[model samples]
Target: MFLLMSSNSHHWNLMAVASSSASPQEKYDVFLSFRGADTRNTFTSHLYAALCQKKINAFIDDEELKRGEQISPSLLNAIEQSKISLIIFSEGYASSRWCLEELEKILECKNSYGQIVIPVFYGVYPSDVRNQTGTFGKVFDELEKDRQEMLQRWRTALREAANLSGFDSDVIK
Candidate 1:
């Protein structure tokens, strides 16, 4: 049986919930998806540290994927293996193609394996993500027209993730 968190009255019983059908092959409890340039030194770092303090095995690709135009296989595997995916939508998240690829894979896993996906709007509005407005839409404008199909996939993933129940850092702080 694999341990999972179950919510009760906004409280999570981290150790109490178990899933017998959950994959034993899962190496991580959560897969973190974020733009390093935006949150590597600030929010993402502290969030990762806090998860570590709680003994939550979370995956954050800081050094492993420093120089890649495409999302690496190992990073995709990390997303597939995790029970939950936490997407931190910052100012530049939609600017990176690599980040968009990761987001697509996370949503795919959510559909196929029943993986949980949570979006954290960090200094960004959910409407902006869903509608691809502001910086999010500006990045799409800069992309080549030849990659229209891929662009559409990324947009759908962003919209879907933005619609989920999640924390808005702006509201919390």
Candidate 2:
């Protein structure tokens, strides 16, 4: 009877352990969000290479998703688990709806999860990002044509995000 009780207790403990165990997080050191056509082969590539050289685990999307397709759940999980997000605000960045959505996610993560957001103003001004000037303004104008409410949200997000500390590529050049 004592041996049977011990075996039952062991099984119960194993069941408890299995039930309580959580899956491992897909943590990343950095997540890079950029307009691939604008800078992927140049600045984005260089930045990714540099981060890799520094032994940082970085995620950058290299493939094109079909229209209406969602970003991979694994990649989204990685983004959520990343310590830092690097946003490359190039000329055509605001033109891409997918990039805008990714930017929104990064900003949301920063606000809710204490993640660090670093904006790289590549050939764009901080004021532009903050105030939606120039290309940023033009993109917002286009967005406002069909989705005024959503554009407002994006504007607020862009303004708040631009306030975060970052590097200006023009200054580096």
Best of the candidates, TM-score: 1
Specify the poorest-scoring 10-residue window by lDDT in model 1. Answer: 1-10
Task: Give lDDT tens digits, candidate 2, residues 1-173.
Answer: 00000123212111101123222453676788988889999988877776666566788888866657766776677678777788899877776777777888898888887777888888899899898889877866665467877677778878887898887766655
- CA lDDT for candidate 2: 0.73
Leading candidate by lDDT: 1
Off by over 4 Å in 2: 1-26, 66-72
Candidate 1: tens digits of C-alpha lDDT, residues 109-168 = 999988989898988988899999988678756767799998898889999999998877
Candidate 1 structure, TM-score to reference: 0.85
How many clashes (backbone N, Cα, C below 3 Å) per candidate?
Answer: 0, 0
Runs with alpha carbons beyond 4 Å of true place in candidate 1 = 1-21, 64-68
What are the TM-scores, per candidate, against the unseen true structure? 0.85, 0.79
